[model samples]
Target: MDLHQLTIHQARDLLRKKEISSVELTKAVLARIESVENRVKAVVTLSAERALEDAGKADKALASGENGYLRGIPCLIKDNMCTRGLRTTCSSKMLENFIPPYNATVVEKLEARGMVLLGKTNMDEFAMGSSTENSAFFPTHNPWDIERVPGGSSGGSAAAVAADEAIYTLGSDTGGSIRQPAGFCNVVGLKPTYGRVSRFGLVAFASSLDQIGPLTKDVRDCALVLNAIAGYDPRDSTSVDCPVPDYTQALVPDLKGLRLGVPKEYFVEGMQTEIRDSIHAAIKKLEELGAEIDWDVSLPSTRFALSVYYIIAPSEASANLARYDGVKYGFSYENASSIWDALEKTRQFGFGPEVKRRIMLGTYALSAGYYDAYYLKAQKVRTLIRREFDEAFKKYDALITPTSPTVPFKIGEKADDPMQMYLSDVCTLPVNIAGIPGLSVPAGLPGGLPAGMQILGKHFSEETLLRIGYAYEQATEWHRQKPPLN
Candidate 1:
């Protein structure tokens, strides 16, 4: 049996029945990584030693009749999330040599559940860009076509799962970092409501907009991972105090009498014809399954969501990234005569162009003379975006849209065009603005490239979105199709 291809639920049953051991599974996964890492460039640090150790523990636990969903599962972690003693570079030279003494809250949770860490995957520097090409180490290529990008930030995690290098992986979503990549890679990625999962150990990008989520092979795995990570932590001031439901319970095939909204604003121009056709077909399938599709839904503020996200996300990022000065924990510039010079040199040498660009934009927006004109105005517009979602949710169970306007473009296709690159997240920014939940389920391929059908839901309403996505996923064969990487 190909152990690397087993989903969490499938693997758990085998482990429970003693049909397979965690060590064997881990070996199979590691071998797959070895075979594909060079071509895909998905992983940065491979924790082979640590993975084997954890797999042994899981095997012993299973031998002693101890069973857990993730106890014996091998998975990958995005580099931005701190992993104690493991290098978490965030795909930047800034922290290349820095090792955290602690694990992110999500990492700690996964470890507690018996998951084996397979090493950290690559990402855009500090999760700032739409394509993984911005990584300081190297850009992760799409497993489908090496010439194409795997989508940004969480691209490595998505590519690894698509290539079966890992059962599943964790990714952070700040303005579609998780979902967009998942969409491009033809996987399931969920961006939970902001604060539904603790951000205590996450390397911050945009604190208010940042969310940790799962990039999984299927919707069921997405739920299983979400059940393990969703909860409140006192350490995170933004953590929401709410009960996390058993997300697996939402896998029902029924969508009868459910009300779904389709905001006209999301179906904007410049969307590829194939993507549009696929989404329309998906909506039709949902209707046939008894979901009432409200085509008249309009979120007027949606037009401004991308602009608001750019302004507000950078502002928050500016504040969160201030600690990376030369004197602190990350990279530092030596041989400087003064502290000011040292700070200047460190930041100049440490941050990549994209990171520095955002910092400057944020600083400018938050400057004394322009704070009200830009930052404050963006916040007010952000509120309107949230209100729009709230009003829509009052009457609909969830909203549907294309995950990205286009399929994965060739690597370097938009590298020189910053505005074009930012457009990748245009359809997904509103969910973050409203602090709501969104899931990108693999929709049928358009022009042979994977597209995603995004389901948006109310705050903490992940169950409903999961139910909708699961039903759609079950109705189609998109999730089962593998990229032609081998």
Candidate 2:
């Protein structure tokens, strides 16, 4: 068997039947990483030793007839999530050496289920940019085409799954970090409703907008991961105290009577012809699968989402990242004459250009003179955007749109163009702003590159979104297509 291509569910069944031990699976994954990590640049801190140790434990437990869906499965984690005793660099020099004393709640949940942690995947510096090129260390290349960028800041996690470096991986999405990359890489990525999963151990990019989610090979694995991690945590003040339903139950292959809406604003002018056609075909497929589509849904504020996200996300980021000065942990400046000088010097040297750019933009937005004109107004507009989604959901079970406006672009294509970079997440940012769930599933490879179709649902409505997504996935073969990495 080509162990590298097995999904989480496939591996779980094999482990349960003792067809393959976790140790052998872990080794297979590690071997694959060793073979491809150089070209993909998907991993940041590899924990081969730790992974083997955990796999050994899983094997012993499985032999004793104890097994769960994720038990003995090898998985990769995005670097931004703190992993106890392991380096959790957010792909930046700022936290390059920072080791947390405890694991994030999601990590703890997965570990409890006996899931093996492979290693931390690369990401944009502090999860700020749309392309993985913003990493202070190195940019992660798309597994599909090494010359193109893997969409980011969760690019490494998505690329890892797309390249079969790991079965599935966890990624944090703030302003489409997870979905955008998943689209570019041709995998399944889910950004659960805000507060649906704990953010306790996740490094904050934009606190209000940031969310942790799963990027997987298939929708079933996506739901399996969600089952383990979606819940409220007292550690996260923003966590909603709600029950997490069994997401696997939403995997029904039939979508009869389901209502889907396509906002007129999402299919904007100048959208790439290939992407536009692919999404339209996906909608037609859903309709053929018994879904009713509404074409007149409108979100007038859609055009302003990019502008609003830049303002609100950076403003929160400016506040949250202030803790990274040269005081407690992380890198510190040695030749500083005073405390203030040390703080200034550390950030100036440690933060990447994208990080610095956001901080400056945020600081200026929240500054007293411009607070009302920029930050406050943006918040008001955010409320309107959220309200529009709320109203739309009342009439539609889910909303459909293209995950990205275009397929993956060549590396450095948008690196020097910040506006173009920000626009990459235009279709995805509103879901975050509305605090709703969104899933990116492969639609087709138009122009010989993957394009993603996004499904948006009401708050805590991941099940509905998954149900619709699974039906579409069953009827299509896009998810089965793999990048020609080998």
Candidate 3:
């Protein structure tokens, strides 16, 4: 068997049986990376040396009978998460060489559990775009069809898993970054409820909306990764202090008696035909699996989510990103005549077009007079959106929809049109706006690209989402369909 293609659970069983060593597994993964990294451009920094050393340590530990689920497994992380000594560039030129002095909380947690770190994957510069094309480095190609995008800004992480470059990978989602890419690449991606995972060392995009989660080959593997990373951290003031259940316990094969709502608003007009059919088929499948289906559920406030997200996220981003003024860390303009010139040039030379666009939008929204008119108004709508989901959950266990409105479009298809690109996330922005947990599972391959069924649940209701996702996954062959990469 190709070791790189094995799931985390499969690899775990073999390692514990003394059938395969972590070093060998790691090498297989690294070799896979070497063979495809050029074509896919999925990785930003490859840490083969560090990965081998970590694998060697894991092997010794496993020899002593250590059986941590991730002990001997190798995985990739989105470059936005700080990894001590390794560059966490956010695929941007500004912080191209800005290595963090400390590892992000999630990184520390994974390492503490004996997970082998393969390296950092690429992302849209500062996680700003719907396609990975915004990366200051290079666009990460979809493994399914290199001419198409894998989705972004977690594009690299999703592409890596689909290509079998690593067993699994971590991704951050502000508004569908994880799930959109997961759908595009035919994998499973989860965005835990805000604060479900620590973001202490994460390079902030939109603080209120950003949450780190995993993109994995299947629902069970997603559960395993969530079990390892979901928890509160003292460093993150927003991190929730709650008990994390063994997510594996939630992965039962049926969704019997669970009430699932199908939001009418989510099936917006102009959506691709295959996408609509796929989601409808998913809803039908859920009904067959014993879920009580609510076909006309309406989240009225959802109509305003896109506008609210753009305003609020950019406002937060403008505030959060104010630190990169060329005086502190990251890239600086040395030829500037003075501090003001240096600050101006640093951002001008460092940030990509998308990043600058968002920054400017945010700056304008947060400006003194516009604050109440734009940012405040958006927050009011955000609360309404959240309340709508809250009321829906009173009658439903989870809500279902399509993750992306369309399959992975060809690269550069939406590049020149920012509005069209932003609309790519129309279905998913509501989940983040409500600060709820959402999961995207491969639903079907339409027109040779993948469409995903998005499962959205109440805050901290990840287990329920996983239960529903796991059930749907096991009953279908979608997750088993590999991309035509090889």
Candidate 4:
């Protein structure tokens, strides 16, 4: 395998055995980026020089007998997270030149482990769109087929991994941003329970729904990355101060006694037949591994997830994004005739169409006369959705569904139709609404396009989800199949 294609554990083993230097591995990855980045366009900022320097330091530490699972590994992250001295544009012109003064909590933890940072990946502007097409710079293409989107707003993160641009990448999921893209690109993506990971440095899209997780080559790598980043942070008020288990321990190859449920609602009438068939195959495979399959389960309130998510997420986004005024550190319109005009022009020109649309939707939802009708009602229904999941968990260990209703679509397939684009995440937004954990793993290739099996669990049940994902990954050859990059 190419050095860039090595999984985290594979690289760790080689690095420990002194068979490959960190510099060699880092260079291989950088070279891979140089070769295919033009075709994939998954990267936003490339920190080649700094990454090499960090790799050199890691090599010296290894020579001195120091050890760490990720010490010499290099990776990329979605551009939305704060990285000190590095541009974190979130694929938006508003913060095109913005450099954070301090690192996000997760970045700090990775740095502490001596992990090399390859740089930042692209995303939907302010993470508002389902396709990376909404990026202010360029759309990220799927490695499987360049004409198709990789999925978003974490498209670049998943695409980079799919294209072997990085060993693994970090992506934030609000409404299927990570999982949908992972499904499209054929990777392992997990959205941990809302408070399981710290959000101190994540640029907020929807504060209550956003959670950062890993996009990896396989389920084991997902667990390894999660072990490194999942923990409580006093810096984030919403962060839960719970103990984070070593996720690697949950990688048992059997589902022996677990009860995995399949909600019928997820198998919608109009979903692509390929996805529906692939998920059924995954169910059969899990059953072979000894998992008790509850083939007919109900989470009826899930039908309203897209609606509730649209209202609640945008409402939170409107408030969270208000900080990007012209007067602050972001883009400023120097020629504006007045303060309000400057603010208006700065945002007007800085944000993309999707961002503006969501902001308007959110603002309207929270407006004086509409609050009780739209925002309040959505929150109330959000409770109903969560309650339904809560009730389901009482009878089952985990829930299963397709990560998305369809495979990767053409770059502009749904770009002009907002509702069609919104429907892309129908299988996933409910997890965010319920604030639980969800894992997306490659199940099969339908029409030569990837389909993901999403495993959902109760809050803080990431270990169970990881266990389930790992078992599925081991039993199937799907994750082992790399994209053809056609």
TM-score of each: 0.99, 0.99, 0.99, 0.99
Give the residue spans of candidate 3 off by over 4 A.
Answer: none
lDDT of 2 by residue, 1-486 (tens): 689889999999888888999999999999999999999999999999999999999999999988799988899999999899999999999998999999999999999999899999999999998889988889999999999999999999999999999999999999999999999999999999999999999988898999999999999999999999999999999999998899998899988989999998888786798999999999999999999999789999999899899999999999999999878999898999998999999999999899999999999999989999999999999999999999998999999999999999999999998998998899999999989999999999986699999999999999999998899999999999988887
lDDT score of residue 63 within candidate 2 = 90
**The 10-residue segment with the lowest total lDDT in model 3:** 477-486
Off by over 4 Å in 2: none
Residue 71 of model 2, lDDT score? 89
Candidate models: Cα lDDT each: 0.92, 0.94, 0.93, 0.94
- Relative to the true structure, candidate 1 reaches a TM of 0.99
1-486 in candidate 1: lDDT tens per residue?
A: 589988888898888888998999999999999998899999999999999999999999888878779998999999999999999999988999889999899999999999899999999999999889999999999988889999988999999999999999999999999999999999999999998999988999998899999999999999999999999999899999988889998889879989999998988889888989999999999998889998888999999998899999999988988898967578899888899999999999999999999999999999999999999999999988998888899999999999999999999999998899999899988889999999999998876789999999998999999999999988899998888877
Q: Write out the backbone clash pairs for model 1.
A: none
Clashes of each: 0, 0, 0, 0
Where does candidate 1 stray beyond 4 Å? Answer: none
